[model samples]
Target: MIIAIDGPSGAGKSTISKMLADSLSMHCLDTGAMYRAVAYLRLHGDIPEHDEKSLVQLVRKTELNFHHTTSGTQIFWDGIDVTVELRAPIISQEASRISAWSAIRKVLVELQRKICGSGDFVVEGRDIGSVVFPHTAYKFYLDANVQIRASRRQQQLKEQGIIKDVKTIVAEIKKRDFHDSTRKDSPLTKAAGAILIDSTSLTKAEVVQKMIIEIEKIKEKLGKKGKTN
Candidate 1:
């Protein structure tokens, strides 16, 4: 079974998804990291911002991999570990832009499908529940208020020693949110039948536990139907 968790930035999707995957003993696929990796590579290369054709070509030639370890999820691009490099703010901003391209999304969607085909995975991304895995066994959409989201992001940046004013971070987040929601290809929206969870005041453990309850309900329903048949 596959669990799809979709949400915007700083909504606690990553932490929740990782915990949920570990509890279930399943693989966790961080789709956002894949886009970030691409963005990181593009920033270091000759790829232009508006060159969709070149971007598509670059994606095809690149090999992206995700590995789950005792430490955490590690991302690789063409066999090079980029776990730390992809976390830069520059790459984060560029990732939000690159992911809006339809051609790039198509390639990544295919890659995502192939990865989840053979194993149980907790996959999280903007479109994971809505587009990438519409038929997934469990789908969740996590969200929080814009201000709260911005605060969380600000705290994260501060911890990384990339200090910035709250106003600036909030502005940047709002800009990215607008682009993500209004993008033509695979705009971020909750999938039909997805359970919505607002993390405005919820702790990380609380969110994970709530999702676990939902997953249990799904398992019960499936099991009952199977026994009836």
Candidate 2:
């Protein structure tokens, strides 16, 4: 089974998806990180963002990998472990831009589908449920208030020692949301048949547990149908 978790930045999709994947003994695919790695490559390599043809060629040439372990997921680009480097604020900004491009999104979506097709995966991204994996076995749309999401993002950046000022982080997050939501290709939105969860007041553990309950219900229904047949 594939569980597609779609949400805005700082809405806890990453944490919740990882936990859910662990509980189900499935792989967790952080689709956003893949795009961020591409952005990091573009910036460091001095590749222009508007060059769609070049970006598509670059993606075709690049090899991205996800390494799973007991602790967490690690991302590798071209055989180098760049798990931490891709999370930098600069790359985050660039990722939003790169992800908005139709050519880039098309290439990455094909890669993502190929990966998930081989194994059960818990995939998380802004458009995972809506665009990338619309026919997933279970789909969820996680959301939180804008202020709460901004505050959470600020705290996360501070913990990582990436940024100090909460105001600046919050502003950047708002800008990213605007860009992501208004993008022409596969803009971020909740998928039909997705279960919406307001995560503003819920802890990560709480949200995971709630999702587990929903998964169990689906499993039970499927099991009953199997027995009936």
Query: Relative to the true structure, how large is the alpha-carbon lDDT of every model?
Result: 0.85, 0.83
lDDT of 2 by residue, 1-229 (tens): 7888998898988888888888878889889888987887788666776887887787678776777654456888789999998888888888998888888899889988888778778899999878888766588999998788888888888778856666676787788889989999999898997889999999888899999898777668777442110
Number of backbone collisions per candidate = 0, 0
Worst 10 residues of 1 by lDDT: 220-229
RMSD of each: 2.3, 2.6
Runs of candidate 1 with Cα error greater than 4 angstroms are: 224-229
**Candidate 2, pairs of clashing residues:** none
Residue 111 Cα positional deviation in candidate 2, in Å, after optimal superposition: 0.6
Candidate with maximal lDDT = 1
